[model samples]
Target: CKCPLGFEGINCTDNIDDCSNHTCQFGVCIDKINGYTCKCHSGFIGKFCEITSQLKSSLLQNNRTEILSKTCTPEICSNNGICYEDSLNRVQCRCSPGFIGDRCLMLKSVHANRNDSYMKLSKPKIFPHLNITMIFSTIQNNGILIYFGHMGHIVAELFMGRIRVSHDIGNSPGSVVFSYHTVNDGKIHELQLISIGQNFSLIVDRSYTRFINNRGIRTYMNTSEMDG
Candidate 1:
């Protein structure tokens, strides 16, 4: 059957969606006759929006010009952001919550008062490798900050002015409370959490860095299978 530039079906009546398989790596995809085009976000370029804007200032420590040979990679996405290739095979970043930017290096602040609101994902997620960073403040001395996982879960909370983390890799869940600085001073504090395999470490910046250079906390169940 004879079909137009962007028409399909046995009788050439169905309009073909060229954009279905052509997604912009950093911006929007617009469909055209038998093809698609990309509208890259600020600081990106390429036929499929795969290049980073940093290329414009390619300079060495001595201010020598550098050259480009490839597009962005998994390392390009910072702040626990994940890099991916889009439908058109261009580079893109999957940022964590409270983050934005082409490389996910910027923080998007969220202000919450007493019982303001909470967010629940409509789907479950997996985290073979994870890093989460945030800044928060509270007048209360105890509460949960973040909770994630399914069969194996992890929870970070404020335990009596200290940072506590509860985790379960595959077995029973266990917890560890940071014994350093206090954080419930009604002022903002920075929190960074990282997990490699079954090991985990954290840093709570409240006039001090806690738990980062120290030991990691492992999660396990007690004789009564209770959260510690």
Candidate 2:
């Protein structure tokens, strides 16, 4: 006798399969002579494996079913980052406070000793317009504040209880001095230097002094560096 669709027994009398259309849904199918069985995959259970486990189904539905494969692996994100896609759909490496950068690779600050300590900074491009201001309290009457350009062509120095800024363009050299009697009295003082249209001005405690050099070559604060 010829066997019917799901049955392959000699007499075709055994109902071995409980699967649908001889196939399993979210499960595996097995033959039982004249029938088949549905061996449900994880998180599913039923005669045909059609029912979802209550707790696990809710978890998957709430967490987006499609992105289950896009999760961050434990080895992927550094610095203990709980990886998740941001609203912009871009991956973000969330960093804690006092930490920054995409991978949290930078620290905000480092403790340093009082003497022989320095911090490094990236070099920046030069701009034409410039204004410099300094507020300081010093007991020394002779020291350098700011020096720049080749051979210290431009400088702001403290000499003999006075703040002096000297600039030289071609052969025309000029200096502006702000002599405050109490400058070295260990009191805070403000000094500002402003450059515009080949001219510079010095202001000490709101007292303004304008210096006009020989009107020939236009000059701006050109410097390879500036340091104390």
TM-score of each: 0.42, 0.39
> What shift in Å separates residue 192 of candidate 2 from its native position after superposition?
0.8
Summed backbone clashes in each candidate are 1, 4
Encode model 1's per-residue lDDT on 113-215: one tens digit a residue: 1263455534322234566777887777888888875555667888898788876655553445474777899876778776655666677773544332212
TM-score of 1: 0.42
Candidate 2 at residue 31, lDDT? Answer: 66
Instruction: Name the 10 consecutive residues with the lowest summed lDDT in model 1.
Output: 60-69
Candidate 2: stretches off by over 4 Å: 1-127, 169-176, 180-182, 223-228
Candidate 2, after superposition: displacement of residue 164 in Å? 1.1
**Candidate achieving the largest TM-score:** 1
Clashing pairs in 1: 174-220
lDDT of 2 by residue, 1-228 (tens): 787765656897766454334434457777675567878888666666655454244445655344233545664344454566878676556754333444443333322222233334343222444577766666877777665554224567778878877865333554444544446667767777765645666777676565644245545444444553
